[model samples]
Target: MCRLIGAVSRHRAPVADLLGDDLDPFIRLACEHKDGWGLAFRQEDGTIGILRGIDRADDSDRLQHALKHQLTDMAVLHIRMASPNLAVTVNNTHPFGDARAAFAHNGEIRPVAALEKLIDPDLLATAAGTTDSERYYLAVRERMNRGVTPGDAITLTAQAITQSSDLVVSLNAMMLTPTGLYAYAQHDPHSEVIGRRGPAYFGLSYRQEEDLVVVASEGWPQPAGRWAALPDGEVAEFPALHP
Candidate 1:
């Protein structure tokens, strides 16, 4: 489980500018979700750039610097609360990807072995971490390799896992691609964790302004009227500016 924030803008801007007043509170979420942090953005050259640290976002000087210095028309941030048995390591941190795209997941799929079985062998060999989140990402990437759009890739992977795995708590995640940002939200409303964390635990919401669109996890004080919930079991795409 984790918290995520992502944005697509018409002009290059720092992520802090996109979050506005919500930045601090979002960072403070690391106080509880204190395992690792990561951020990914499109570089000037059009390649995806990522920075990750196995430290709480609230306390990481590196994160602080990036929040101020890094600027992009598209970006995604993740603060991880390591799932049971997952170690706190850089490789396990999020916003994982290659030059084409970046991804961060906010839920877990049980018996990760089952999900692993669905991934192509070559893709599986590239995994740098054991977290189900990584496998979940590779699953989507596998489909993308076959020419599927990011949103469809996510939906197909989610459907496949739910059909073959046990106890899929959620498949909520944000994928930042070369052209746009995609958010996927799918969770078991009746699950025990949702009951404990409240119905909004795995929920995702977005706010679209004239120049930018922002999507984020539920945790802090985003005004209900201003932020629209991204519908469950579906994917939402926000286009970003490109060279």
Candidate 2:
């Protein structure tokens, strides 16, 4: 399993500050998730910038510098622990998406070969690394290109995974679009609680007054306001250009 954090603030604020003492704990958790790590954020121009690596996120000097220097209204962070057969490389890091969007996933898909068959060959051709997460992203992109909304595409992807293997998926993922942010989690009965965080492992909290929204794999301990856990199977969308 992996961990992720995302935020969209009304005013530019340092995420490191908001995370507080949680930062060290979260980073420690990420260090155990040694496969890879990534961070993506939107520029003032709305262009997405991403930095990723196969090293432990807590130990990466480059990632640390980028995080300390870069501040944005919107951002996504991911820590990965590669499942068997998945390669560890920068390209395989989470928070993958194009200009119009960004995504981070925390889950594993079983029978990877079978799932690969459902993806469009052209999109797969563009793959920079071999990881189920990347395949899942491409699958969603292909479905969207064929006129499917992100929600519908995700549903289809989930359905495809179910058909390919009996292995259940506990997909905790988020999508950040020009319009808003969306998140979904699919947990199975067999899921185990490995960390100190409660059963509700993922949450998205926002302060409308401040026009700030935050989505994290685990909730922060401070700076409390209106933070809500996104229900399973539902997608939370925020307007890109708010009125």
Candidate 3:
């Protein structure tokens, strides 16, 4: 479980601007989602990179520094609320990828032993840390190695994991490619799971304004009914609004 934000705009924009407020008074979320944080995107020179730290986003100078331009093209900002037993370290950060793609998740698929069994062996080999999020990315990459698109790969990989595991599954996730930002929101919709404050905060939402399309985890500050919830169990792409 975590908080995530992804955005794509025709013109360059800073991450802070897209995330709304830095020290948002929403219970100081940036300070609370303190497991780790990361920013991943295709740089202006066409190389993708990640700037991250295993520190609270509110305290991470790196997060603020990179966020100044994380949304430069297509990018994602992830503030982790790591699952139980997962270490709080840099290797376990989100938006896992290389120069061509990046992937992040806001949900959990438990029993790493079982999850790893279903994942591709090669992916497991390359894994630098132990996290369902990273393994999910590897599984998707395995599907992509067969020639399907990244979005399609994610869908297939997610389906495989769901069928293989009996544990509760929440696949709210996002992937950044040169073409667009593809996100998936799937979980138990009617569960009594929610903050003591309101509805489930793990859902994904987005809003498009003129030339920019923004996606974020629920519970972030947004005007009433301004954000659109992503369809459950579906994969959708948010291309640059001006593209």
Q: Which predicted model would earn the best lDDT?
A: 1
Candidate 3 lDDT by residue in tens digits, 1-243? 788788777776665665555225432576667788888876776666787788887887777677664556677878888887999888899989888778999877766676688667766899988898898888887777779988788888788888887664578899887677899988755444443324657678788777778787776566647788888888989865433
Whichever of 2 and 3 has more TM-score, that candidate is 3
Model 1's alpha-carbon lDDT is: 0.90
Judge candidate 1 at residue 127 and give its lDDT: 98
Error of 2 at 55 (Å): 2.1
Per-residue lDDT for 149-199 in model 1, tens only?
Answer: 898999999999999989889899999888889999999988888887899
Query: Which residue segments of model 2 deviate by more than 4 Å?
Result: 13-22, 191-209, 219-227, 241-243
Least lDDT summed over 10 consecutive residues: which range in candidate 1? Answer: 234-243
Best by TM-score: 1
Q: Sort the candidates on TM-score, descending order.
A: 1, 3, 2
Please report, in order, the local distance difference test score of every candidate based on alpha carbons. Answer: 0.90, 0.69, 0.76
Per-model C-alpha RMSD: 1.0, 3.3, 2.5
lDDT of 2 by residue, 37-66 (tens): 887776767777777888888888987777
